[model samples]
Target: MTFLGVFAWSPVSSATVTTTLGVDPGAWNVWRNRRLTPAPLSRTWFRRASGSPLVYQVSDVLVWLATKRGEHIDPLTTWRLSLARDFGTETSDPVEIRRLAVLYARAVGPVIGGVRFTTAGFQAYLASLLSSS
Candidate 1:
């Protein structure tokens, strides 16, 4: 005698997953080097102002430089030096110097940080003084 048997079939399913991670050592080195290096003076405004012949140009630039380096500059003394440099002792007018000294003292804010001066006011004052002279 012979016997017959039947079997059922079923389908199978599968899935795949992938992941990646990496870092460049050179990038870390560049970042570290940048952090350790001091910042260079790249101020374009300062460069432009340096070329001008205004009475306070030199003093303004000096005060700006001092402020950038976290220091202070005496505005009165700076103004005096600037005047002397721009106009030698032989040519410097005592009355004009005294007037400018008063203007500087009025415009200067304090002795702590960066000195402040009103450019328009100073320019107008200078123009008037020169026109009168």
Candidate 2:
């Protein structure tokens, strides 16, 4: 998903971001500042962690895939599914669990955007991946 950078910004630590998205916060900082291209979509307040240590909200990491991107869903459904697997959330049988994961990921995978992203998806995705592979 693509954000126009108009959403509310929160004060989150890099540890929170890494714990959720499994990516180093430094990469996001570099990419958001335009130093890198086609990196995960994240919106940050500052470019570098010069003065104070950087902080990141879980939403910052999810905005890349959950927000709108051009026309398509940016990372594609397959990518989302793969991400779910990698994160340990399988999209297999058992309609109830799969449905829950889908709903969770669609809502923003283990984080909150406008108070929507939550840990439900995080656990679901992680669980799914573990069972699948």
Candidate 3:
């Protein structure tokens, strides 16, 4: 079920979700591993191939963000909304999303949950997550 006309039924990388939400990769990892984040479609829709990256339902992510707003989570909620506001709720351009990620990341500083989340760190994480695919 697609909402906001973004990813629809498509698979979204963890890095795309993390960068789009402006959250540190480590926090994202923790959230998913702890079940704080919604389960990805990969969990039941189909078996992911041995080396493919896990994918999430964009609608699930949006709903989770909308309801999880709090002191620590508010900033991420803001970034999620900002993408809709700045580029329309339907916007899903990777280039623009990454551009906005850079802008927002700089303003907030690259540290969250005590992890130093530089662009390099993000790129590295993305590489690692995608490398096996």
Rank by lDDT, highest first. Answer: 3, 2, 1
lDDT of 2 by residue, 1-133 (tens): 2222211122244444554556676776776588442332233323333354444333333444444343333222433444354456555444544344355544553443322222453454345433321
The candidate that wins on TM-score is 3
Which of 2 and 3 is the better model by TM-score? 3
Per residue, candidate 1 scores C-alpha lDDT tens digits across 1-133 of 0001100000000000000012243443364367522121223212223333112223333454467679876434454555564445332454655576545434432210121224554344344433321
Q: Among all windows of ten consecutive residues in candidate 1, which has the lowest summed lDDT?
A: 9-18
Residue 27 of candidate 1: its Cα lDDT? 48
CA RMSD of each candidate after superposition: 33.4, 12.3, 13.1
Candidate 3 is scored at a TM of 0.42
Candidate 2's TM-score: 0.27
Model 3, runs deviating above 4 Å: 1-5, 43-51, 70-133
